[model samples]
Target: MEKFSTHTGIAVPLRQSNVDTDQIIPAVYLKRITKTGFDDALFASWRKNDDFVLNREPYRQGSVLVAGPDFGTGSSREHAVWALRDYGFKVVISSRFADIFRGNSGKQGLLAAQVEQSDVELIWKRIEEEPGTEVTVDLESRTVTVGSLTVPFQIDDYTRWRLTEGLDDIGLTLQHEEDISAYEARRPAWLPRTLPART
Candidate 1:
């Protein structure tokens, strides 16, 4: 996971509500076990239409996505976040997001900023008016800025801290490596050992 202290990039406005996991990566693309290749499958069905927002030239270079309400609404698939991250979206700004999807985003080091609907609309308008305008998402300041406008967004402290430190769940657990080793050394001899077999 990458440290997400601050990101400034072109914002792509995906002006649709109730965007579910299937629409994000589609079920067909879910067969793969690896994470890197999903970029092509992100919004796979929607990209068939040449006029889709992501298919446009400047928007294709966007690293941030500003979406409508109820974003990532169906299923608890973490793949949705994978697809977004693989597609080069570091942050997604929305008025509302599915709880599971938001959690998945945090775990995957993707920033899901929840802001007021007015602010979301404003961001969409600004990006539409100026196609290549840059938007800045500052995790430390908890704000999103575009042009002269800056709006505060909400994110839980723990998630923010994890992202700031680039700590995934495994990385967090490894922080106590010495303590874990110390504890294992003191285990009873009668207890079954859990060491891996040599190949």
Candidate 2:
């Protein structure tokens, strides 16, 4: 999990609403347990149409996905986050997001920014009108800017801190591994033990 700071990059406008987890990465691609290769499978069905925004060359390399409301609205797969991250997206901005998807995204160090629908529309238009348009998201200031538009958003202090530090759930737990091991060692023997029956 790389630490996030101010990011300025090309914005890919995915104007469709209610983009579910399946669309983000179809179920067919879920056969693999490894998180390394899902990038190729992202928006698989949509890309097959050759008319989707992601299929367009200008937005192909974009890292910030500016999408419609209810982005990541279905399912609870953490793979959605992995697919996005592996595909080089660091932030996903939308008017709304499903609670579970948002939680999963945060755990993986992806910024799920909630901005007004109107602001989202503005970004959508900007990208369409100017394919080379660049946007910047500043996690530190909790703001997103594109052209003349600047939108302020709210993220919990802890989430923001984690993003800035690039600490995922595993990273956070690893920070206290020593203490956690010590506490576990002090546990009562009656605690359901899995240690090879003390051979």
Candidate 3:
């Protein structure tokens, strides 16, 4: 996971709503065990249409995605977040997001900002009218700003802290390495160290 502070980049406007994990990275792409190489699978179905926002010039390079309401619905697969990150999306702004997807995004260091529907619409219009215009997401300030428009968003303090510090679940656990080592050293010899090996 990478630290997320302030990001300013072109915003890709995804006008459709109810975008589920299946649409994000089709289930067929889940066979691989590796964490990466899912970028090509992100929005695999939508990419087939040449007119899709992501397939357009400038939008293809966008690192921020401004989507409609009910984004990231259905399924609790963390791969959705991985696909988004692999596709170069640092932040996803929408009016609403599925609870599981939002949680997954936080764990993966991807900022999932929920703004008012009006603000989402404004962002989509701005970016669509002027492709490649930069949008800035300031996690520290909990705000998203585009041109003269600025909107405040809400995020739990813990998740914000984790992302700001680049601490994933493993990273968080590692912080207590010394304590864990001390506990392990105190284990008694009476406890079976390992099960008897089977022939």
Candidate 4:
């Protein structure tokens, strides 16, 4: 996964709140095995309207999503994060997020920034008024900035460290590679074997 110290891009204002995992990529689209290529499936229902926020210009290319409170509120699906990432979103801003969804996002390297509801509305107003304005999300600074306005966002210290360091679950595990290798070398052959044991 890529490091997420700071990301600046066009911000898409998703006015609706309580956006669930199903609304993100629907269960029908989960058939694909790969982590990517789900871009087309993202917001499948909403995108059909042509008037959906994401279907609009500049927003179609946006990498930062500023959504209302209670975002990612439904089922726990890592695919939801995958869909957002595949759709080119590097960060998602919301006042509140479901616990499971937030966890999935962190593991996938998607920065889920929790800002106050008032700040979220302010962000929406800025983006909606300018329509294509770029917003900067600085993880290191723990702030989201649009034009002259800047608002703080909160993320756990551990997650912030992991994201800023570009460490995912697999990356975290690999940090102890030498220790794991050494331990495995000391294990008895009788413990287990991929290949069948000789009779």
Clashes of each: 0, 0, 0, 0
lDDT (10s digit) by residue, model 1, range 1-199 = 7888999999999999998888998888888888666889899999999999999979999999999999998888788899999889999999999999999999889999999999999999999999989999999999999999999999999999999998869866999999999999999988865676534
lDDT of every predicted structure (CA atoms): 0.92, 0.87, 0.92, 0.92
lDDT of 3 by residue, 1-199 (tens): 7888999999999888999899998999998999988899999998999999889999999999998899999999999999999999999998899999999999988999998999898888888889999999999999999999898977889899999999868867999999999999999978774567545
Which of the predicted structures, 2 or 4, would earn the higher TM-score when compared with the native?
4
Per-residue alpha-carbon lDDT of candidate 4 for residues 5-66, written as tens digits (9 for 90 to 100): 89999999998889998999899998888888888988999999989998789788999999
lDDT of 3 at 137: 99
CA lDDT of 143 in candidate 1?
100
TM-score of model 1 (CA atoms): 0.86
Q: Quantify how close model 1 is to the true structure by its C-alpha RMSD in Å.
A: 4.6
**lDDT winner:** 1
Error of 2 at 58 (Å): 0.8
When summed lDDT is taken over every stretch of 10 residues in candidate 1, the lowest stretch is 190-199
| Rank ordering of all candidates by lDDT, starting from the highest | 1, 3, 4, 2
lDDT of 2 by residue, 69-144 (tens): 9999878888889999899888899999899998888888789988889888888888889996889999989998
After superposition on all CA atoms, what RMSD does each candidate show versus the true structure?
A: 4.6, 3.6, 4.1, 4.3
Against the true structure, candidate 4 reaches a TM-score of 0.86
